[model samples]
Target: MRRSSSFVLGAVALACAGPDRDAAPASPTSSDATGTSGGSTTVSGSAGTGSATTEAGDTNGATIGDTTGDDGASSSGGAELGVPMFVAQGMVGRTTVSCDDGLTWIGERSWDVEGDAHLCGSTTPVDCSGSGSTCTQRWFDGSCSEEACDCGHSPGFSKGVEHGAGRFVATWGWGWPGAVATSTNGFDWQTTLDGDTFGGLRYGGGRFVVASRTPQTSLDGITWTASQEADFHGDDGVTIWSVRRFGFADVDGGRFVAYASGDTSVDTLISSDGGGSWWRPRSMPSDCLGEGPGAYGDIIAGNGVIVMVDGDGHACRSDDGGSSWTAHTITDSRIASSGVWTGDEFWFWGFGSRYSSADGITWTTTPIDAPDDIGPVARSPEGTLVAVNNVWLGYEQQAFLRSTDGVTWASLPDGDFTPGHPIFFIAFGHAEPSAMCPGT
Candidate 1:
């Protein structure tokens, strides 16, 4: 993991309206732990002063090398299960793949081109496979399937999505400003141009928030506003700077928290009342301040608390929303970039090991069969857990791991991505595809 090079250049004029918290979130320092900020550099933070203790009752129920674990059908939630979708954005093309049970995936060619730009129909499929499959049409020039134009070659990268209430809003961008595609049915989409650069787009508390360089919010997924502005304070509670960028954001307890790394310190941007407004806390955790803690990973919030963990085996808990933080050390350290709050416990992992905690203070470790780099973990609305490993056969191929209890993981079939292109994003959710193209 590395630190981001971008910084707030001019003096920030925004006011600091957040609470006087004890500490902020963690930053990455090692190659294993990457920061949420765009740039990758060595991250450093203060070490925890408290003693590290291991849990007594071992939770190691499954074999560490077993990849044939049972599919957790019993833990599936009441919500209707949709197609499991994954997006692979290479240097040239963006591939959207869907699976029924996550064991197999079928890629959807969102765009294609001939001598002249012509939209491929169900009879003549383009980049995706299938004889009679009508691929979901997406246009780069703000034109969806309604109009026929020759500008369908650039299928933008699908950044993230917010789905609920029979609606699906997916954000995508590559070079230019970000845009959104809203769909009542996940198959066909209506594209809208957005001002903010989309990275970590999230929807919570009835509002949508984008954690881009210039953070923006929207009541609906279309009309966006740059309302999340605040001054960042260092651990000393005096040095202030403008928030230039944000990363790793989550919504819980009616508050939206986004991590921001500074030149010398790290801070979190907080928004209460749904992404309508934002602020930064006064104080920060001494351990999280002044680059040296080793490695910062990701943030997960649930069960009335927000927890941030680093690759150096340190964990910080913020109980009063984003006000203050308490640091704790894990006995066994695992480098993890993504974590999931399973409504009962927190699970974070990297390659071979998995870490879990019920109270966010005392944590236990469970070795897994994962042998590659796990980037992000997504839980379906039906409670099925899916994790994406960046490397399977090599760096080119990607693998999917499924778990029902967040403990035992089963390796699914490998994704047939382009030979040298790596997958940038992965997601699993419920989608109501149109009757024309039922998912495979």
Candidate 2:
């Protein structure tokens, strides 16, 4: 119970993504990582109705010449509550580089074990010992020696990692579900599935898919079952909010077209035979006119054609398989997880313009002057392109930061990313600070 950031707040209950690239591949995200801000006020319409209050992904605090209170203490980190990010500084310390927005910036480190030593979990393989990478839990402090509080650090959302033959996979997420971890040389990693593994673990040709919202399968990523599962409620149930392999990826004949979400509808989930068997959704153009509430992102097949995105920033395209779809322009929206070939042609990211789409349908936006404000978007098979800056209180000290193109950035937070991978949604936020935006 250490109090400083105003009597203390909490986050990082659990995280997942393994396979020894280390951390940052538990993918699948439309974030609200729940930084738990508390007390601040005002939230508007749209985005449902707003009012949910979670703030803290990046809270440098006030800027654009100072907002309401302007100096709670936030130099380059004020906004980013949703998107707008900046972090890059290490060279001799942070290491790992390859910019130009192709991504490949692995940094962000934290220990949090109270500092010295005291978390002998998993029998203490040197602390967290790297089993399936490392994801231990037990923070209680409720008194009478129930103290186990091991903030051994967690938020490892990286945007890089590619281990071929020796094999390694990490597409983040666990507290929100969807997890994947598999390794051969990256480390001893073992756990294979947990939840929300969409958006950044698509191996290609030989094939290996990730985006588990009930749908699970693992021939080699290291043991996983549950071919396809769903239950967003609805029907006589009425819960609605289905989302399975969210977006970006298109192939038509050999088959591998996925972009899911059922209850609210916006479909296209055909796996041909590679992804085992998938084909029970549709609507890319059942007749595009416009619906009520929508949320979709991640499918980006490119050149061969298949672009589909969401958060309303619009980047829809289909060529012929999902029936029909055409609309592309990503200024900003929710774009949670992205990829399409890599560079030059199609590279979309959320949190207001981290874009590139040459053929996906015209787009260029690329402006990520981030001190901290990256909401969604993650890519790194080789094309690089990382801009994940989400930091609340503990990842230890620094917070999250990394930027390749979109305009220079680097925060390090400390330094991490050897095998770590958790690209759940790496865009960025916080632009309103120009005196909150109006003509600043």
Candidate 3:
């Protein structure tokens, strides 16, 4: 079942240097991968109230806008239920926080290798399964010393993080081995798959799908099945081999959409039967990749609509389920890194002012105070919007922001997270797996 909020909803640049780039060699096998709107609803107080409701058409529907509450803690008064915590993945590591109401956040776990160093000799990869370690590691030549470290790898860094179909999934990008981390509860994680992987992850139709040079799917996010066709040939006679990079993958209108951009062209692939089969829609326009400095951006699906935008001011939207697309230019030359759907509107944000649209075309600009890139936004089931700025730099005190109405934002305190660590993506997901299945 699709996760929903009573209201309605809704990336990263692939070329920028991830914080881990200095510590680790880029994965030769992986591919580079890599918002807001309306309202002025104010959420007051701290977080973790567990009093927010996400069911649509509630009596409070008429009260969603222009309402003020006592200053106890902020509450969206909506968000997807069963989601007990917030999951964040970035260059520093993966961490979780508990905030039932999406206002006052409390730390849950820092799920990355922080202080501990693992040694695996010159050619061997560091084994991060030891105590105080969880895969994100700096590899050294022959010792566990942090100095003279040659390379490092994290399953999910500045790319490939998605939450859906009952699990939160994160994966490593190019130059590293294919690694995936799955969590039913944000507090704990399991490395479910490794090897022969490229990260363009999406969970839908009762399964998890990864689109790469090869396409693979999993019923439980553990064992993956790869497709037989290694080369993806579009109806236009254009063929892309082993998708080099994924712009973004999302499920909207009960259809799974994955955007793949190679050296020559940009392609949009859609799967109607829960990722069991995929076919290219009419190919996205070439300019959808962007003419700006950063060539890539993100995609979002909701309310029978799918929209994609790149950092260079190009956008594409599909209303009839990816069969055809209409192109539009983002206003003010806005460079978008990420976007989201807020029940009633679509939003795109990046370097400067944020933009929101009721449809995917015309937009309304909202001013913000970020001096650097502001992006990778996510919404809670109860309708809280969380965004991080200075994605590559910035301290936690100034990096995290939350809003119930998307218009007003407040700084969020650091919760068991490294103060200066940069965040890549934020998602709301269940703390427990909804079910289990046998795997290969």
Model 2 ranges with Cα > 4 A deviation: 1-244, 248-267, 270-297, 300-316, 319-322, 325-355, 358-423, 427-440
Lowest-scoring 10 consecutive residues by lDDT in candidate 1? 8-17
Could you give candidate 1's per-residue lDDT for residues 257-312 as a string of tens digits?
Answer: 56544444555666665555556543345554422221124555666677766555
Q: Report the Cα lDDT for residue 188, model 1.
A: 59
Q: Cα lDDT for residue 271, model 3?
A: 61
Model 2, 357-401: lDDT tens digits are 556655555555656444333443332345444312222322344
Query: How would the candidate models be sorted by TM-score, starting from the highest?
Result: 3, 1, 2
User: Compared to the true structure, candidate 1 yields what TM-score?
Assistant: 0.62
TM-score of each: 0.62, 0.27, 0.65
* lDDT for model 1: 0.45
Steric clashes per prediction: 21, 78, 31
Cα lDDT tens digits for candidate 3, 1-440:
21111111101232342321221112111111113335321111111112111212111111111111111111334443454556666543345454454554444333233331222222322232122422333322222333221122342333456665456777654433436778766655676765434646655444666776567777777777876343454334566443423432232324556654334333456665545556665434433433321223466655556777555445566676666656565553445346766767776664446666676665566665543345567776557777665444334233566777665666555553344344556666655632221111
For model 1, state the Cα shift of residue 235 in Å: 6.6
Q: Give the per-residue Cα lDDT of candidate 2 at 133.
A: 39
Ranking 1 against 2 by lDDT, winner: 1
Model 3 lDDT at residue 213: 50
Judge candidate 2 against the unseen true structure and give its global Cα lDDT, from 0 to 1: 0.35
Worst 10 residues of 3 by lDDT: 2-11
**Candidate 3 vs. true structure, TM-score:** 0.65
